[model samples]
Structure formats: structure tokens, C-alpha cells
Target: MKSLQDYTTVIRPDNNGIFAAYIPLLSGCHAWGQTPDEARAELIYVFEMIQEEYKEEGRSLPEDVELVIANAS
Candidate 1:
């Protein structure tokens, strides 16, 4: 089973002093909060909701990917 921690979360503070978080792997999955921690917490909830929706729709959940860089010779 895939867990929330399996995905990569991007969190940043917006100009309005609110923290915004989004999962790059999950399209349109985002949340906002007053602080980074709060934003992350909300993002977790968002992830759960998205996962449930996928399950209901009989779709497979997206998997996380790892990026690798290689030096060009």
C-alpha cells in the first residue's frame, strides 16, 4: 500500500503570509495553512481524499519517482 510519505511534497510561503503545499506527482492536489507544518498536515488530508477518490473510481494511485543526474562527459 502506498503511504502519504511516499510522495514528495513541496511547501512554500505565499506572499499573503500563508503556507502552500502541493504534491507534484498528484495533479491538482494542494492545500494551504498558516505555517509549513500546518500546510503539510493539510496536504496529508488532501492526499487521503485523493486516494479515496481514486479507489472509488477504480484507478490506480500514482507512484513516486526518483530523479537522477549524470555528468555529461
Candidate 2:
């Protein structure tokens, strides 16, 4: 998979204690969670979805594809 670019993830709390996971790289694919853990979990799915989309679409995975860890706190 040739990565076109890398993306950043921003996680923030919501009104209901759920976090909004944002992929700075992608315009969409945000997920909500009742907790930071939940948000993180959702992010996994979001990330996977994007990869699958590319695979199913017969597209190559971006070179930037990597596990988001530095952004984690």
C-alpha cells in the first residue's frame, strides 16, 4: 500500500462524556463514545473502515497508514 499522506487524530469530550474522535486527515469518519476508551475503540473501526474501503475499491493503502500512538495520551 502506497500511502499518499498521513493523518492526525483529535479526540475531544462531548456533552455526554462521550468523546468525538476526529481524523484530521480525512474530512469525515468521526465516532462518538461514552468515554475516552469508547472513542478510541470506535477510532479503530473508523481506521479499519478506511483501509477496507481502499482495499475493496482496489486502491492501495497509503504509505502514511500506521497505528496512531503519538496522539494518544
What CA RMSD would candidate 1 show? 3.7
For all predicted structures, in order, the TM-scores are 0.84, 0.64
The digit string of per-residue lDDT tens for model 2 on 1-73 reads 4221255567898887678987765645688898877887887787778777878999865443455567656
What C-alpha lDDT, on a 0 to 100 scale, does residue 73 get in candidate 1?
100
As for candidate 2, its clashing pairs are: 2-63, 3-62, 3-63
lDDT of 1 at 31: 96
The weakest ten consecutive residues by lDDT in model 1 span 61-70
Q: How does model 1 fare in lDDT?
A: 0.88
Question: What residue runs in model 1 are displaced by over 4 Å at the alpha carbon?
Answer: 67-73
